[model samples]
Target: MKSQRHRITDLRTRRRELQRRAATYRASKGTPYPVEVHLLLGQTYLDPASWDALLHSRGPAVALRRARFAPRYDQLLRRLEEAITRYERP
Candidate 1:
């Protein structure tokens, strides 16, 4: 078992890694992903329902644009299929 101190250190390291990835992603010039996708990607029944509610309440979109986002849904579905295939019984 990892000591509490070790777990905290790991958490800090993971946080830094995520921050670095975010910075790199921001620097990239590819078609930008809406910050809202992370919100939309989140499922309401999950442990993070409070966060999902907050994100869903506020839109990165203007009043003219609805907060609907399905951009990553297909890709996520594909990945879900792949994962299910991996666990399928012979």
Candidate 2:
């Protein structure tokens, strides 16, 4: 039974961490794609679409079920991870 404020704070913290990682990656590789992808992911985590879906889900059981069926959630996360991995390669 986490409070909404805590959840929002967690999301913000995750976004900030992603941005920091993106900055580090950009500094190391001198590329914009990794930065762009990380920023996009951060934005996505804060977007209304995500909040609306989260709000609709409510309880833990329903939230898990909603996550399993959410159309773009997994795809977007996977794409972000793939982009980061590609950037990490020499």
Candidate 3:
């Protein structure tokens, strides 16, 4: 069996890879999957400053912009699929 420290290290590596992937995707596409965007937006809302930024940026006026995220949704689905595959690869 792996040591607990090793498992924790592996998890951190995986998280770093995921964030790297997200950054690469964002750099190339200027946006990410809708699910990713949703997650980010949720996280943002949980912060006072980010929530204030969103509230003052466009709010309901730009909500329709979110509907145009089919490509990003596809990207997120691919990431989710990969995560599932990895988890099941015992």
The candidate that wins on lDDT is 2
lDDT of 2 by residue, 12-90 (tens): 4555665577668889879776565856666456566755656555778756655453435445555665666677677
Which regions of candidate 3 are displaced past 4 Å? 36-90
Task: Give lDDT tens digits, candidate 3, residues 1-90.
Answer: 763334334433444455566556657766445564446433322244533442344555434433333235335555654643443343
Sorted by TM-score (best first), the order is: 2, 3, 1
Comparison by TM-score, 1 against 2, better one: 2
Q: Give all candidates' CA lDDT scores.
A: 0.37, 0.60, 0.44
Better of 2 and 3 by lDDT: 2
Candidate 2, position 46, lDDT: 55
Report the lDDT of model 2 for residue 56.
56
Estimate the TM-score for candidate 1.
0.35
lDDT of 3 at 6: 42
Q: Ten consecutive residues with minimal summed lDDT in candidate 2?
A: 65-74
Decide which is better by lDDT, 1 or 3: 3
